[model samples]
Target: MDATTMADAILAALGGAGNVRGVTHCATRVRVDPAESARVDVTALARIPGVLAAQVVGDRVQIVVGPGRVEAVSGAVRRGAGSATAPAHRGRLSARTVGVLVDVFTPLLPAFVAGGLLTALHNVLAGPGVFGDTAVIDTLTWLRGPVALVGLVGAAVFALLPVLLGFSAAGRFGGSPYLGAAMGAALVAAPGLTADSALPAIHLTPETGWVIAGVDVLAIDYQGTVVPIIAICFVLARLERFFARRTSGSARLLLVPLLTLLTTGLLAFLVLGPALRFLGDAAAQGMEWLYTGAGVLGGALVGAVYSPLVVTGLHQGLIAIELGLLSTGGSFIFPIAAAANVAQAAASLAVWLCARRGTRLRALAATATAPAALGIAEPAMFGVTLRLRVPFLIAVGATAVSAALLAAWRVEAVTLGAAGLLGFASIAPGSVGPFLACLAVSMLLSFGGTLAWARWRRRRGRPIDGEDPRRSGDETAILSPVAGRRVAVESLADQAFAASALGPTAAVAPESGLITAPVAGTVSAVAATAHAYGITTDGGTEVLVHIGIDTVRLNGDGFRPLVRAGDRVAAGDPLARADLDAIVAAELDPVVLTIVTEAGARTFAPIDGETRVVAGTPVLGPVGSPENI
Candidate 1:
């Protein structure tokens, strides 16, 4: 699908643009903070043509559109959301602060996480007894410098976090980002002073410093600390903007910097600095109390809420607590987090099992669950479990049990990669066995629970989230082969699909790479280019599904045809997975044409334009025919 179409579909799935409080994107997912998380339709979102998955973290909606496309996708979504949505009604001061915090921190997670992981690695390599009783530069002395360089590179990112956060905060706060960077650099350079004479016991001496307001200045280093740095930058940016509007060019530049620094410095030293530090420390203390006093119950609570925190972007804030945990002892959060992810993935897999065979729902669920097991749970979480609600609760319930067990057994990871399979190796040296056991137990519980729930729903004749609609044996329905926006074939710029040469054709702007079988019939022909499929319907209608314009020239570059000629398949069966990005990159229109190729089919069933649908919804066939039944 075109970026605009995908954007439209995404916004619609997110309960229209009005539900969005804030929207942003990283490499793979377009993250949106929804005004009402309940309104979001995750099942519909997963079936959107190009959407790889959808997840809700806290109140945020993360639509995974795959790599390299989110920049355009997010831009489109932002434009549409901005135009359609009203100003956000921020209810509380804390909620407003959190929104700003998420905005400032969301863009920097990759760098921040990389630094944390590197720090953990450094601890593993250089902490006690590495040479095991051999003192002076023994076995691996030659590797010392290179390993030190590895630590240095990672440390550089940590040390300079203040500058990055400052820049992001300024941009978000509507000020010149470079000014924010300069202010941050100043904070780093002025590393706070101590007063020895007035507060004599600590052996620190007072020095001449610029006292802003009544407070004496001591510039403490802001390395690896974001909350304080962002606060300072927010104030600095506003100050700069306030100055900029009142002054002109050259004087504006110089005076703005001078005044901003002076005022913000004073505020930092007198207020925001101490306040943010206290908040950080208090947060650490609270987390400490929770872990120490609450024990297994604390672990249960953390596991239950962790994924929600991740989605809301609040989990990024807890990163500080994780770092603190590392500094104090081992981190217990990682195991619980792993359990939550693994259990959710298991729940999604169970949903796939309960889905009817040979349906688009089954194919998508199967495709979405694997990434979760590998630690990318957004797809399975948003695309499957949480999308259905029941599975999500089941997964969370299983997580509490597993996390409680983890707490009792004292499982911890020395590092921060909390993905399901990969996280196993990150456990603190001897805790791997218990960790795996908890994981196994959690997965089985969630999986068994999901299956039981799905069957119960079926027995009661309740609408199963993944169930296919019942169809008659002689039904002649032409369901949509791809999830996307419907466009009349006549509206094509090239008009090739609608030419007099071709009969009864329609076009779809597909948002997904996967193309499904549109009719229950035999595969009449699979085009050599793999850009088209010919299927003869069970009612003797031969249909041609041509993927895109000029797609044949790409010579099957990113197209994976999953079925072969003469294969008997039901409607919603997987036919192929087309790389929509590759098609766009090659400068081809990713419009799919579904034509009734039989000799004298004069007309198709009535279909409307501007319609968005999943892969199995009715698009063409006997619905409009005289002998429709």
Candidate 2:
């Protein structure tokens, strides 16, 4: 489906637009905060075209739709869902904080990437080593102006970063973006506030200043500072809102902006800016201490958990810290991130190489590898490595070792860019060789380890997909729960059942009201609405028997349960009786669904090409079993 259709489908699966409290997107996922988490149909979401996976992480529902496609999909979702403000009591504080950081910086990636690449270009042309210590620009004197211009253009983004941050932060905080830019402009470009110039009335050192009204207003330059502008924007948002509420009519427009700017500017200069700059400095120093003091161990630790952090959506907060570190010349996070990205790509490539051709696993692995190598790892991580389990662990272990090597070599990135094989351009000129070396180590170990594991499994006559290799002698036959025409699970109207997200599934268009036990088992649960029953077979297969599509809304008006939790059941025993006429009159589908919620060690294969089946007849069983044949 296209982005618009996908957006509508996603909104519907999220219990419709009315159920959404907020929506946002990062590099590879569209995150939604639903009004009721219980209402989200994750199974239906997973079945949507282009969705890699659907998962609930804490209080938010994240739909992975890949990188480049996420922006369009999320924009459409946001428009369909209306407002983006989340309810205060809905999510944890830390999650909200991370969301804010992601919103403010994700839009600035293009600028960062362009400037970083140009900077690398400038380094190559103007710096030493092009001809035995003579720079390329020096040898070709005509290239001097162009080379200088490239360096100048490259430096502009970092030098005026605060303005861009301020504008983005203010919009995120629900204030005027232009005014926020004004605040940043004042900090960086306004006279007397910069280190280059001071107020004529006062004599102060460039590095130090006296206290004003008990607040020490430091004379530090805020050219590329991150924290100070963000903090100032937060206050600016609140101040603008406060003024907006108090003023009215003509006074509102004129006074709100004026008072908001004047008051916020004063506070920023005398308080928040000076104070938060220290915090930003301290955070940078702390990261440097971690990089330099703890050294290789610290890099290993970061690499090991970096992918896990991405899974949890906590990596968003790291972007702010990374920007802060950039103000201090370079960031260590980028190199480690690069190692982890390359490791995941290599592991996915191994899976693609080992998987049998024409299999779903091979197709997914093949599709995910290129993106992972280009610095987007979600596809490889979610679709291939994590699903197989061992490959993901192999990638993590490889990343840890490679990141340690990078740290040992003191590799760091001067700017933000793709954190994969192409990331060398973003690395500090002196560390590019080391970055590539460590990246090679990451690729070799992850690919070799995963390929070796696959070969070992093959040698033992086991499935490379990480499934059990048990013989068919241990098979179980799951009988049809009701007498009717057998229907393919994929043909069912309910996407949750059609996707078989619950597990291996079968559907029957019931000709009778009686619902029988599909297998001899113990009842695990009986829905309060009397429309569903959960049974665990003696061989340890979980089965869910849902009476009809959306029958729970009837509130047991046309249903009767013959079983309860903890009750033992025999194959062909009546489990429930549904009033088919009442269900038809209520405009609900009366198709009975039997799903293998959990197959455990057993593998389920449904019988195909059966137009009709009697109650108590085999509908699903293990592959190679008589029932399956």
Worst 10 residues of 2 by lDDT: 466-475
Off by over 4 Å in 1: 1-139, 187-189, 192-221, 302-402, 410-432, 435-629
lDDT of 1 by residue, 1-629 (tens): 98989999988988998987777654345778788888899889878987766766556676766433666788689877874232232223543454565556546655544554554455445443333433223456875776677678767775776787778888888777877777666555554324434434433444555456655445344555666777788788878867866688899878987888888877776788767765555654564567668989987776776666544323445666777777776888778778887887799899899887775446556866655665555556545665555787899889888988999999987876535755766778889899999999889999999999989977754334422355323445567889999887666754234452245666789989989877666677665456777777545677777788757557667787766555546677778889999999998999877766553443566355348878876677555553343
Go through the candidates in order and give the C-alpha RMSD of each one to the true structure: 17.3, 16.2
Per-residue lDDT of 129 in model 1 = 37
Clashes of 2: 0
Using all chains and alpha carbons, the TM-scores for the candidates as numbered come to 0.42, 0.44
Report the number of the highest-TM-score candidate: 2
Tens digit of lDDT per residue, candidate 2, span 1-629? 88989999999999999999988664345779899999999999989998877888668888877543766798789877875542122223553454455457656655654565565566667765433457788889999999999988866876787798889989988899999999988877753443454565554455566576776655456765666788899999999987876788999988999999999988998888767665555544555566677888987877787776544333544677889878898988888888888899899899999876755567768867765675666557656776566798999999989988988887888887767777776788888888999999999999999999989977754445432223121336778899999877888765446677566788999999999878766677665556778877656777878888767557677887765555556666678889999999998989998877667776888877568889877788877777666
